[model samples]
Target: MTNPPYGTAPGGQWPPAGSPFTSPAAGPVSSQKQSRGPVIVSLIVAVLAIAVAIGAWFRTAHSDVTTQSTTAPQQFTTQQTSDANKALCDSYHKMFRSVNGAGGQTSDDPVLQQVYAINIRLATHVASDFMYDKLRENPAGSPQLASDLRDLANAYNEVLMAQLADAPKTELDPLYSNIDSADAKLVEACK
Candidate 1:
C-alpha cells in the first residue's frame, strides 16, 4: 500500500486539535445552597442534649425530698403477730366495757361527754402506741393475720373517734359489734 499523507491517517485526522494535559473550562453555578439539613440536625441535637442535662439536674436537685428509705420493713412470726393483735384487741375490749359502764343517756351531759372523750383518747393511745406501732415496725408473718390486725386497729380507732363525738346509745351496739367482728377475725387468723 502507498504511504499515508502527513497529519492524517488512513480514515481520520490525528490528535483532533486538543491537548490531553489541559482541563475543560468550568460551567457557571449558583452559589451552593447552604445545606440547611446539617444546621437543622445540629440544632435538634443541641436541644435534645440540653433537655437531657436539665432532666438530670432536676432529678439530682430534688433527690433530698425523694431520699430512699434505708431501713427495711420487717415481718414477724405468727405468735408475735398474734400477741400484737391480742394487745390491740384487749385495749378495744376494755374501752368498750368502760364506755358502756359510763352510761349517760342524754347527749347534752357535758361531764359524761367529756369522760367519753377522755376514755377515747386513752384507748386510741393504747392501740396506736402500744400494739399498732409495733406491728408497723415489724409486719405480721401471715398476710391474713396482718390484714385482720389492721382491720382491728382501724376499727378500734374509729370506735374511739365515734365515742369521742358522743355517738348515741343506739349507735353503741353496732360499733361494739364491729370491734367484736374484727377481734374474731384476728382470732381466726391466728388459729
Candidate 2:
C-alpha cells in the first residue's frame, strides 16, 4: 500500500521508482532535460539591444563634439576682431574730441587752432592714404584700417599733449598749411 517514491497516482500507483517524476532523489538519471530555448533567445536579444544603445550613444556624442569644435573657432575669431574694432573706435573718438573740442568748433586760440590743424592733417593722411587704401584692398572686415587709425590716434594724443604743456605755436609752424591741404584733400576724397 506504500507509494513508489514522490506521490501515488489516483489509481494508487507511482510512475516508477527510477523515474524523475517518481522521486525527489533522482538527479543525473532523470529523463527530462530543462528547456534552454527562451533563455538563449533572451540573451541574444539583450546583447543586440545593448549594442544598439552603445552605437547610438557614440554617434550622437561624436556629432556634438564635431559641431562644437567647428563653431568654437569662428566664435573665438569673431570675439577677437570685435575687441580690436572696439579699441579702434575708442581711439578714434578720443582723437576726434581733441581736434574738434567740446565746443563743437575749432578753437579761436591761434596755438590751439594750429595744433588741431596738425592733428586733422595727420588723421586725414591716415584715413586717406592708409585706412582707405587698406579698406579698398581688403574689404569691410579688414583690420589694417583699424590698426592704423589706432596708431595715428596714439601719436596725435602724445604730440598734442606735449604741445599743450608749453610748446610755442612756432614749434608747429613747419607742419602748418601742409596739414591743412592734406585735410582738405581727405575731405574731398570723402565726397
Candidate 3:
C-alpha cells in the first residue's frame, strides 16, 4: 500500500514558522548569544578566591610566634638597673683577669696571638650579650644609656683588636683615646 503524503504543519507551511528556539543549521550564528561572559567571570573569581586562601594559609603556617605590640615593656626597677650596670662592669673585669691570668704558659710569640684572638672573641661575645642583648631585653631601658654602653663596649673591643693586629702607634693611640672617651660617657650614663 502507498503511504499518505507528508502534510503541512499549519497554514500550509512545512513546519511551524515562528518559534523561540531554532536549529543551528537554520539560524545565523550571531543570533545565538554567547553565555561565556558570565562563565569567564565566575572562573576568574574562583581562581582568585583559591589564590587568596592559599596565601592566607601560608602566612599563618610559617609565621613566627610573637605578640603584636607598639609599646615597650615596663622599665626595670632603680635597684635592678644599678645592679645590672655593676654586673656589666664586673663581667668585663673578670674577663680581663682570666685572660691576664693565663699568661706565662708558653714563650712562643704565637701564644700572644692566640691569646689576642681569644680576647677579641670573648670581648665581642660579651659585648653583644651584655651591651646589646641585655638592653634590648629590657626595651624600656634608657636608649641613651644603651647607646653609650654599646659605644663603650665597641670602643673597648676595637682597641683590643687594633693592639692584636699591631696597628701603628698613632692608630693605636687614637683607638685608646676613643675607648677612654666612651668609657667616661658610659660611666656617667650608668651612674
Candidate 4:
C-alpha cells in the first residue's frame, strides 16, 4: 500500500509536519491548551508586581516632600521700633543705677567703663535722630548748621567704628578727638 503524501506513511509511525502530536496520558487536544494557563498566570503576576513597585515609589516620594515642607525653619524678627527705644531707655537707666551706687570710686572701673562706652553709643544714636530731623526741617536754613550736622554724623561714625573688635585704643583716640571737635563745632553753631 502507498502512504499518503501529506500526513504519515501508512506502515510507519513517523508523523508529518502539519499533523498534531498527541500524548498517551492527555485526554484531548484541548488539554494542551491548558498548559499555557501557567504562562498567562506568570504574565499577570509580573504586571501586578510592576504596578506595586510603581505605587511604592510614588508613596516614598510624596512622604519625602511632605517631611521637607513641614520641617522648614521660621525667621525671627523684632516686632516693633519701640523695642529698640525701650532697650535704649533701659540701658540708660542701668548705667545711671550703676554710677549712682558707686560710692566713692571713679567711673573708670569695668562696670562704669562699659556704661561709658554704651552711653557714647547712645549719644550717637540720639545725635543721628537730631541730625535727621534738622535736615528734614530745614534743608537750606544755615550753612554753618549743616556743616555742624555733617561733622557730628562723621564723628559719631568714627566713634562707632573705633569700638570694633581687634582695634587698638590708640586707633580709637582719633575718634574721641573727632567727637570733641564735633561737640565744639556744634556749640559754636548754636551760638
Candidate 5:
C-alpha cells in the first residue's frame, strides 16, 4: 500500500496553488528571523550596572581612608590634664576605700562570702575600667603622666586577670606593687 503525500491540500493536491504555508518545492518553511536588539540592550545594561556598583565600592573605600587620615587626635591642655588626673586619683581612692570597707564586713556562710567576693571583683573591674576610660579620653599632656597611666592600666588588667584565676596573695602582690608605683608616679606628674 502507498502512503498519502504529507500536507496534502484540497482536491488531493500535495501543494495548494499560491499557498504561503509551504514552498512550491516543499523544502524548509521560511520563518521570520528573531531580533537581536533586545538581547544586546539587556547585556549592555547588565555590564553598566556592574561597572557602576564597582565604581561606588571603590569611591566609598577611598573616602573612608581619606576621612580617617584627615581626622586629628584630640589634644588636652596642661590644666585640663592635671584636673583630669586629680579627679581620676580621687575616684580611685574612693573606690579603694569602699572595697576595703566591704572587705571588713565578713560573713561566716560560704555562700554569703562567695557573693561578697563576686561583688568586690565586679566593683574592682568597674573601677579599673573607669580609670582606663578617663585616661584614654583626656590623654595626659605630660609624657610621664601618660606613661604612668599606661602602666597603671596594665597593672590593673593583670590584677583583674589574677583575681579571675583565683590567684593567691603571693602571685598578686607584685601586680599591686606595680599599680602603687604607677599611681605614685602619676600623682607626681599631675602636680
Candidate 6:
C-alpha cells in the first residue's frame, strides 16, 4: 500500500515526482563564472593616485631649493659707499640743527624745559641709529664712522638716563664730554 501526501513514485521511489531531491537524467546544474575586470581597474586607479601625490611633493621641494639658491649678497660700488656716507652725515647734521633750533630751546617753565630735553635726546638717539644702519650695510667703507656713531649713541643714552634720575651736574659732565668727543670724530670721518 502507498502513503497519502508523500506517496511513492512510479517505480516505487521514496520522494514524489518532480522534486529537487530527484536528479534529472541529464546531469547537475552549472553556475555562471564571475569577472575580475572591475577589481583590476580599481587597483590600477589607486596606484596612479599615489604616484601623482608623490610627484607633486617632489616638484614643490625642488622649487623651494631653486628659489633659495638664486638669492646672493649685495656688492656695493665706491660711488654707492660715498653716497651712503654722505647721506649718513646729512641726516646727522639735520638732527643737530633741529636740536639746537628755537623749538629745542629751554622755556622758563621747568616742566616745559624737561619736555624739550627729552625730545632732543630722543631725536639724537634716532639719528644715531639711522647712521649706524647705513654704516652697517657697508662697514668696510667707513669703520671709524661706525665706531663714532656707536659711541655717540651710548653716551646720549647715559645722559638721558641721568636726566631722568635727576643726577647731579658732576655725574652728567663725563657723559656730555664723551658725546662731544664722538661727535668730533664723526665730523672728521665724514670729511
Name the top TM-score candidate: 6
**Which of the two, 4 or 6, has more TM-score?**
6
Order of all candidates by TM-score, from best down to worst?
A: 6, 5, 3, 1, 4, 2
Provide the lowest-lDDT 10-residue window in model 6. 60-69
Predicted candidate 6 versus true structure: per-residue lDDT over 1-191, tens digit per residue: 45555566566764445566655453333346556655554565456546656744653332332242245634768887677677767766775676567345767865556455555655554554454455454443444554566677667677777876889999999988998898898778766
- Give me the displacement of residue 186 in model 4, in angstroms: 2.2
CA RMSD, predictions in order: 28.7, 31.7, 24.3, 31.4, 23.6, 29.5
In terms of lDDT, model 4 sits at: 0.50
Q: In model 1, where do residues sit more than 4 Å from their true spots? A: 1-121
Clashing pairs in 2: none
For candidate 1, the C-alpha RMSD (Å) to the true structure equals 28.7
Residues 109-171, candidate 1, lDDT per residue (tens digit)? Answer: 555454444544554535533335434444433445555665666677677767658899787
For model 4, give the 10-residue run with minimal summed lDDT: 60-69
Higher-lDDT candidate among 1 and 6?
6
TM-score of each: 0.39, 0.26, 0.40, 0.39, 0.49, 0.51
Give one digit per residue, the lDDT tens place, for model 4 in 4-78: 767666665554333467543433545454455456546655665576567546532323322432565334244
The lDDT-based order of candidates, best leading, equals 5, 6, 3, 1, 4, 2
- Please give the RMSD of candidate 6 to the true structure: 29.5
* lDDT per residue as tens, model 2, 98-123: 45553244877655554455445444
State the TM-score for model 4: 0.39
Which residue runs of candidate 6 sit more than 4 Å off their true CA positions? Answer: 1-76, 136-140
User: Model 5, stretches more than 4 Å misplaced?
Assistant: 1-76, 186-191
